[model samples]
Target: MDIHGRQLQSAKQHQVFVNFRGDELRFGFVSHLVEALQRHQINVFIDKLERIGEDLTNLFVRIEESTIALVIFSRRYTESRWCLDELVKINQLTDQGLLKVIPIFFKVEPVTVKQLRGAFGDQFRDREWEYRCDKPRTERWRDALASVSCKIGLTFEKKSNESEFVKIIVKEVKKMVQPQENYVVVPFPGIRRRRDTSSHGRQCQEEQVVLSRESAVLVQENSKIANQIAVVSMRYMDIESENSVIRAQLGELSERLQSLNSIIEVVEGVVGKVPEIPEFLMNPWQIMSTSSQPITASADMFYYP
Candidate 1:
């Protein structure tokens, strides 16, 4: 299901996916940028909800269908095999004209990112030796890096203060995610007339018209089915979203109930020892002590009389 209340039968929209290793700063920045994109009504997909180690193939599958791949360049990013493979795949896709690769340098120098040099250079050299390849892959990586640098200006920021960095990236992403007119589908010429035309040469014209009407009806039925599928998908999405909200609220209510239970327990413990009595009434012992002797003397005097 998609935001448009459709079944997402095809991947036609511009999808941006963020690719980054477990660099906390990079994740934070990218996450903030994703929120910004959502605010701007841009559909953004993240690689994973949790960190998966060195599974380049899986990560590639996750982002393969995306239209835009946003790569976060950091110093430690070069050391990860998965990150390297993702970069290679991005380059391959670019060569195949399948995707647009955008590089955002996070606390890494532009020259380092472009040249694939310094720490990146050392890592690539080590890998190349291990593979014992006839052709070095560094050139491809360098070309990809350079291409991205030229196409989109490198955004550099300190790793400590990533909020500001996220804001900057969000601004850039918003510019890239501007809404454009949808592609118009042109129908074949004389399609309606062809259907309307008689088939007197081959068969009865009435039969041809009947067949065409049946075909049109079938097409309409198929269209209705597709629309129904889309509507059901959208309803499921709404239900899932509502479920998430309900779960969050349930968690909050559970916490509040626990707090209230604790307070009730404390109040019960405090009041349990007190005797039950009316505050305005006197004790029975006080009334007996005050009136008993006078009542016995009055009864004896009346008997003597």
Candidate 2:
């Protein structure tokens, strides 16, 4: 299959499709959110990891396959045509009732997104007219943004605890997608919400949080590698067991063929003629199914001359 085909197949069907500006949050909040979602066994689709030089249509496929789409509206999110295009597709699917959308106001207000006034809007509006020549596409983007901003969503303000915020978002995600009886994020009693009163204080706290989150990601990846190793070991053991069975069966067939050869030799010496065994009779295991049952060679399997 071609590269596109392989990518589509591997993308699979996820429960959540995350739409975000890659350059901004590829390694920060997005990573934390994805990790938390995965811990709950909620599959997510993040395009930045797999995007190949403006291969944009495949993302639409991911949107259709997903049951829910999380639109993370950061300051510059609307600036990218890709993000705008995705919102359009998401809006289409959501209108059809084929998909659910959860907008995330990441330091960007919903009113600004709906009204096209803030940094997000400025970035989108300031794009070269040459790039926005397609009036229909631009109109679709405007409608999508205006409509999506009206949905109920989570807002990430300045002073919230990053880790706890992730849990809360994940909890909401779980409730929306899974619909369990009780969806909750247990609080960290000891840890206080980061004080973003001053830029210096916020910077120090953010740096500390970033370090801890990176460490957590490393531990998670290592644990996954270890589990994969265990699975490979189990698969190897299964193959070895099958090999042992094959060898034992071959040995048994060898002994039976020797016995038949001796009988044939005796008969030839007495009557100058010997029975001929069929190929399948000589190698009965060739017709044996892969099941544990063995194929026993029998005299009736051959004809006497």
- Give TM per candidate: 0.47, 0.53
Clash pairs of candidate 1? none
lDDT of model 1 at residue 119? 84
- Count residue pairs with overlapping backbones in model 2: 0
Instruction: Show how many residue pairs clash in every candidate, following the order shown.
Output: 0, 0
Q: Lowest lDDT 10-mer window, candidate 1?
A: 180-189
Give me the overall lDDT of model 1. 0.61
- What does candidate 2's lDDT look like per residue over 190-275, in tens digits? 54453555888767667756766676567546644543554355346548879999999999999999999999899899988766
Residues 1-305, model 1: lDDT tens digits: 23432322144354777767666544466667778778777777775643767554656655556677788877767666566667777766654445666788777776665555578657755765665663455444434445554445556756456667666766777655554233211233444323223355335445545676677567546644543554355346548879999999999999999999888788779987446575334465566656657644666676854
CA lDDT of every candidate: 0.61, 0.76
